[model samples]
Target: MSSTDTGARRGRPPQTPEQAEEVRARIVGATARVFTRVGSRGLSVAQIIEEAGLARPTFYRYFANAVEPLHAVLTASNAGLVGGITSALTGTDEPVELGIALIDAYLDWARGHGPMLRPLFAELHDPASPVSAYREAAFDDIRAAVRGTFTELGRPVPSPLDLDAALHVCEYVVYRISAEAGPGAQPDPETVAAARLTMIRVLLTTLGTRADVEYALEVPGLFPPPGDD
Candidate 1:
């Protein structure tokens, strides 16, 4: 038998509740890695089992199919990202500062979760996938967070800034730019970070005041220095 088969045969004793939860977490994490690498259309249960280093029986005990674990990943990831964005925007009064803080929080989350986010973004449009619903909920959370920012700053949202439309645009821009410059794109992290910041500035121009746009441009760390780029 292959080593994998051998490992499967030597499975551990029955797991306690905490141990089972840990196993489930491992399976979900492995599912995210496999899904990120191959996408949902290409994902295979066998691949997840291999990546997770778990016996087939063990996997089946926790999940009925690959989609289940994927749903778990999406739910957890979206919650964490929304929490980070909300925390980042808290206490920021200026529109420009809010925009900068929002984008910075977004990029930081993206950088931290690039592997999972890439495929999550790619598969977000699949209607049959659980991630589709999760994506919609995430957008709603983002919209509320953005509107709250304006409310907190005592500024009325401009006519041009439809929170829903702006949220969609932000999602599209971030996903597109990351997909284009990610991994094999050969751009360094700083270069990608700068590009993301520039895109946020453009987004701010559409959703924010002229003064906000100008202030964002003047922010020192928003983008790389002229000589660096």
Candidate 2:
């Protein structure tokens, strides 16, 4: 067979960079679906090709291996997560408000992805995984943002250890919530409310001063208590 025959059978070759990127995005999208079905450890190139309805050669033309497209999927996830954090925290200076909003944004992101969120959540703790690196980098970015927030508010910055602890504590709460929920759906509002409260308590108690925590408690329904949920 000639190159022209190959091109014709492959369905018109991508004629421009944008078209090439569209094909790559299609593969990434298919990889996400396959990853959702089997989780990352069980994913395979054949599964991706089946999902994308592409030939073996076409799949190889785009990715070196099954794992490569996963990196692309997670790269987009990292952008979404970090951007979500920025949006959620942008205008808030109150400790309780910031805590609740950030957690809400995270749950919203999880809900947006449905079953796809499960494997992504698992990858957060696997240090060797691409998602883990993305997670750490995003956390560092958020930490820097927090430092800037305090500076802008004319408050003393929390120690690096305290900051890391607070973020990690909140992360653990989110992870537990994700684990408890069914893979095909988001956590119900009641569960989300509980998670919000859990993270808020961690955030206020861990990072905020005694007075900040007291003020949060003092406000009438400023931050809902665990009892409310």
Using lDDT as the measure, the top candidate is 2
Candidate 2, residues 120-149, lDDT tens digits: the string is: 778788877777887888888888878887
lDDT of 1 at 121: 78
TM-scores, in order shown? 0.80, 0.85
Residue 54 lDDT in candidate 2: 70
Candidate that would win on TM-score: 2
For 99-190, candidate 1 gives per-residue lDDT tens digits of: 76777777777767766667777777889767789988987788788777777778775443466555666677667766776653433567
TM-score of candidate 1 versus the correct structure, residues matched by position: 0.80
TM-score of 2: 0.85
On the 0 to 100 scale, the lDDT of residue 174 in model 1 is: 67
lDDT of 2: 0.78
Candidate 1: what lDDT? Answer: 0.74
Error of 1 at 1 (Å): 16
